[model samples]
Target: MNNLFHSLLVFATFLGLLWKIHRAFRRASPIGDGCVCGGELCLSSP
Candidate 1:
């Protein structure tokens, strides 16, 4: 029982970390804009 509880706690922590990383990446990279690899700039629609 204790082992199961420990495993669940660890898994929950891992998932929380993953979510934070995903959010950070999304915030860093805007939609419809390719990564900063010298690619053509995506013009915003008026």
Candidate 2:
């Protein structure tokens, strides 16, 4: 029982980390400068 709970906890934590990383990547655009306001394009870098 204890081992199962421990395994589940580890798995949940791993999933949470993966989710955070996914969100971060989605927030930052790969092409050009990363736009913060979800605008169509960034004309210049700050």
Candidate 3:
């Protein structure tokens, strides 16, 4: 039971890290920037 709990904790931490990295990349991406500009052209240009 203890080992299973530990594994679950580690898996959750790993998923959190992945989520953070994904968010960071999404924030930096051109598509994200284009959305702020509010046009289909902006999205298509990038």
Query: What TM-score does each of the candidates earn?
Result: 0.64, 0.62, 0.65
Model 1 has an lDDT value of 0.62
- Cα lDDT tens digits, model 2, 1-46, are 9999999999999989976775576557564434443444333433
Candidate 3 Cα misplacement greater than 4 A, ranges: 32-46
lDDT of 2 at 35: 47
Q: Please, what are the lDDT tens digits per residue for candidate 1 over residues 1-46?
A: 9999999999999989976775566567765434423244223320
Over 1-46, each residue of candidate 3 has an lDDT whose tens digit, in order, gives 9999999999999989976775576567756645555655345534
The RMSD of every model to the true structure, in order and in angstroms, is 8.6, 8.7, 8.7
| Global Cα lDDT for candidate 2 | 0.64
lDDT scores of the candidates, listed in order: 0.62, 0.64, 0.70
Inter-residue clash pairs, candidate 1: none
| Candidate with the greatest TM-score versus the true structure | 3
